[model samples]
Target: MEEPVRWGVLATGKIAESFARELREVPGARLVAVGSRTQASADRFAAAYGGRPHGTYRALVEDPEVEVVYVATPHALHLEDTRMALEAGKHVLCEKPLTLNLSEAETLVALASTRGLFLMEAMWMACHPVVRAVADGLRSGRFGAPRQLHADLGFVVQVPPEHRLRDPALGAGALLDMGVYPLTLADLLLGPATEVRATAVLDERGVDVDVAVAARHGEAVSVSTASMTSASPRTASLATDTGRIDLPGDFHHPAYAVWTPVGGEPERIDPPEPVLGSGLGNEAAEVGRCVREGLGESPWVPHARSLRVMQLMDDVRRQIGVRYGADAAGVAT
Candidate 1:
């Protein structure tokens, strides 16, 4: 049997906790360490997740036992946190929206490539079995040339003004946190967008409260919306002239999908239940395999694809007037 990969979690936030729960269920994976701003926080996470607690992120990355680091920091910190792990000679699986902008993502990608170390965006949605099945169907012409795509993800957040989700300095916005899901789905089925047009409503702190995006890809077009001020259907659909594929509520983490033939009844498709923890295990397993195989990037979420998505986000931000400090500093805010 292959040895389990030793993992280090670099944040003690909600997302990091979620990943730790799923990490327990992934075979050939071990949670070796967790780092947080406070020793107490790190100790709490480690006690629950089975890892050594490190008060500082630097200590966690520098630990010899940690083979990979999962970056669960807020969007503003992704680039620096990921770079630190890489420079420390550990592979990385960063959370979605790899960086605040394309330039920062490119820097990380280049660094990973140069070092010949594994690095992948933890876009759990892309690694899902059902999502993979959908990609396969599209590739095999099951959908017959996707003509249009529609997706939305949104939820109302009633938090204080200083909450990370409402703070521009922290890279809080619907587009970065929630909008990426629909945009990613669109990219998967339709390829790189050729044109993008977007509009948004910003909160008092200048972070987007709601954002709507429309883009043209090849001959196909996609429409996506995300909001932190309201709840939406949180679904997605890919339509062709002859059929349509529907991903029900929370399409980003869907368990089932439906395909409808033109003028015919809808047929549902479901992948077998995940073998381990809730969907995140798929990406964890994938990362383990990539590291063991000596691959620098995942095919499921390639560096170029990540760059493309970042570029799209940049365009959207420019149009929506959601500027971060990183934009001015030429780094991820």
Candidate 2:
């Protein structure tokens, strides 16, 4: 049997905890360490997830036993934390919206390439079996040429003003946090967006609380919506020449989808494998497979695809008048 891939988690936030917990369900992956800004936070995470705890991210990456680092820091810290791990000679699976903007994402990708180390944005949706199956069918014409698509994700965010979801310094906005899902889904089903236009409702602090986007992807068109002030259906649908596919639940992490041909009854399609622990474990499993194969990036979530999505988000944010600290500092592209 292959040895388990040793893992380290950077940050002690909810996402980090979710990743750590789901890592357990991934075969050939083991949590080895966790790091947080404070010892108490790291210790608390370790106590629940079973890993050596470090007070600093530096210590976590420097741990000799850690083979891969899951950078779970907020959007603003992804570039710094992922860079730290890469520089420390560890592979990385950084969370989505890999950095505050496109320029920062390019820097990290370049660094990883220079070091010949594995680095993937943790865009778990791309690794989902159901999504992959659907995308393959669409690409292969099993679903015919996709014509129009729509996806939405939203929730009533009740956090304080200083919360990460409401802080511009942290790259907080409905577009980045929630809109990326629909955009990515469109990319997977249709293609790279050729044009994107957006409008948003900004909060008192100038953070976008709601956003709607219209994009053209080659011959296909798509609409994506995201919000922090309301709860949307969190659903997605694709209309093609021959049929339609619908994800009736949280499309980003869907368990199943319904397919209906132009003149046929709807058919339920399930993921090829059991969704292990909130489906987050699927990405961890992909990382383990890629690392074992000595790959620098997963074909499922390639560097180019990630960069393209980042560029799309950049366009959307620019149109919506949402700017992060990185944008203000001229670090965004």
What lDDT is reached at residue 28 by model 2? 86
Model 2 off-target regions past 4 Å? Answer: 329-333
Q: Per-residue lDDT for 1-333 in model 1, tens only? A: 888999999999998998999988888999999999999999999889889999999999999999999999998999999999999999999998999899889899999988889999988888888888999888998878899999999998898877778878888899999999999889988999999999999867788989999999999999999999887899999999889999999898787999999989999989855735668888999999999998999999888888898999998988888788889864333
RMSD to true structure for each model, in Å = 1.6, 1.1
Residue-pair clashes per prediction, in order, are 1, 0
lDDT of each: 0.90, 0.91
Q: Give stretches of model 1 more than 4 Å off.
A: 272-275, 329-333
Candidate 1 global TM-score: 0.97
